[model samples]
Target: MRWTVLPLLVLVPLGYVIISAQQSRESGESKQLEAAARHLTFGYYPSSLQQRIYQVPIPYGAAHVGYLETNSWSTSVLYVQFTTTAGGLDTFLAKVGTSRAALRSGSSEISRSQAREASWTFSGPGPWSGTSMHKNGDKPDHAISVDLHDPDAPTVYVVSTVNFRYGFRDS
Candidate 1:
């Protein structure tokens, strides 16, 4: 009887410790996500607007998450951006591909092969512009903004956005 009681005491505390650790881990992840979202400093995203958006699961090894949000329909959009030298984007893409995340459809075709892709015209040191739309089966369209070019020399900034949208338009 004494031995059984002692064992029960040990087991109960061990179980409680395990449960507490799990809860702590989940809490830590939530905090990390909040931190990641707060780190996006794009001028277009103000604190008020930033609060309106939330962070989504990020692919492993991706450098930074620029933006993330979802509409009432559950359609969502995410912007994943990286700043690296001309030779670096390919390496970034390769790492991202290894994570098996679905890169926004047309993004894979945009090569980082040149000092600047002929497809993109550098607008200035800020975000250069372009947009593309994709149709998702039975869902709303997805929009991808063109890679914004950095205005100055050694254009190392690039942004790739994946958007899922759904809504009725007034005819």
Candidate 2:
């Protein structure tokens, strides 16, 4: 009876280990998704706005080349949108593909190539209210703006009141 009980105890512990490993793998995947969403929003701006826009430093790499767009969707509200790409980050699609390929290729196989894309969005203070337009014309690659009245503060209050447009590439 002692010998039989020892085997059963080992099997139960092994089963728990397998289950915990699977859960850990899933949580990691979820974190990757959230990161992808945040990366897509960087340096995006909407078009046809009076405010001056400029590029912010990305730190340690070439700044992403793109446009910015800004528009007042409603009273006391503004919308900014832009699209840019950066290296050193994995996208959601790539993450999924890598996982699938790893399982299919087994332990010895490796991916030969990489992929990237431009993720776009409308991010700003105040309520976002408008139809996002995607037409070809003279527009900033990325767009972002501030709300004049959100009970927090005016968007232009903290910054200098001047129209400024410039670009910088980090090495």
Candidate 3:
């Protein structure tokens, strides 16, 4: 009886230690993710994960890229900013289903509210062009603004919104 009881006591503590370690590891991972989700991330090279998740076509050779992502129960928003060469800019525009001609001179389709949400300053370094493309129903919208001060290397800002306003589904 003494031998059996000793083994039981040892096994109980061992099992508890194993389970506690696993729980601690999992908790640490979740905490890191939560902290990352709470802040904006910036990089020269765009994150492929974010690009795929958001369906953003940030062209190759982009510089000074930055992004912020926000989510809710019903909506997700991706804000992207980058600088790209002239050809890269054209490619980006085409991938988003628009052309350079779609951009109107001296105007931005990005709303003040959207810019505020992204913490972006749309009022430029000068000479801006922009476009707003509303895709098919249920698809996200793309509103872009470009500071064409140096046309060869333009600074671009984009706001892509998925889903919709809370409690405002088009059903």
State every prediction's TM-score relative to the real structure: 0.38, 0.26, 0.72
What is the descending lDDT order? 3, 1, 2
**Clashes found in each candidate (C-alpha, N, C closer than 3 A):** 8, 26, 0
Q: What is the lDDT of residue 11 in candidate 2?
A: 94
Candidate 2 per-residue lDDT, tens place, 1-171, comes to: 999999999999999999999999999995565344422333432222333332222222323323222223221112222222322112211321221122211111111110012233223443322111111222222222222223232221011111222222221
**Off by more than 4 A, model 2:** 38-148, 152-171
Q: Which candidate ranks first by lDDT, i.e. highest? A: 3
The collision pairs in model 1 are 124-151, 125-150, 125-151, 125-152, 126-151, 128-148, 128-149, 130-146
Off by over 4 Å in 3: 1-40, 44-46, 164-171
Weakest lDDT window of 10 consecutive positions for candidate 2: 106-115
TM-score of 1: 0.38
- Provide the lDDT at 109 for model 3: 78
lDDT, residue 56, candidate 3: 81
Candidate-wise lDDT, in order = 0.38, 0.29, 0.81
Reference-based lDDT, residue 19, model 2: 100
Residue-by-residue lDDT tens digits, candidate 3, 1-171: 999999999999999999999999999996576446633456644357667656688998898887777878777888888899999999999988898999998987789988887677767676989999876556677899999999999988888888765344454
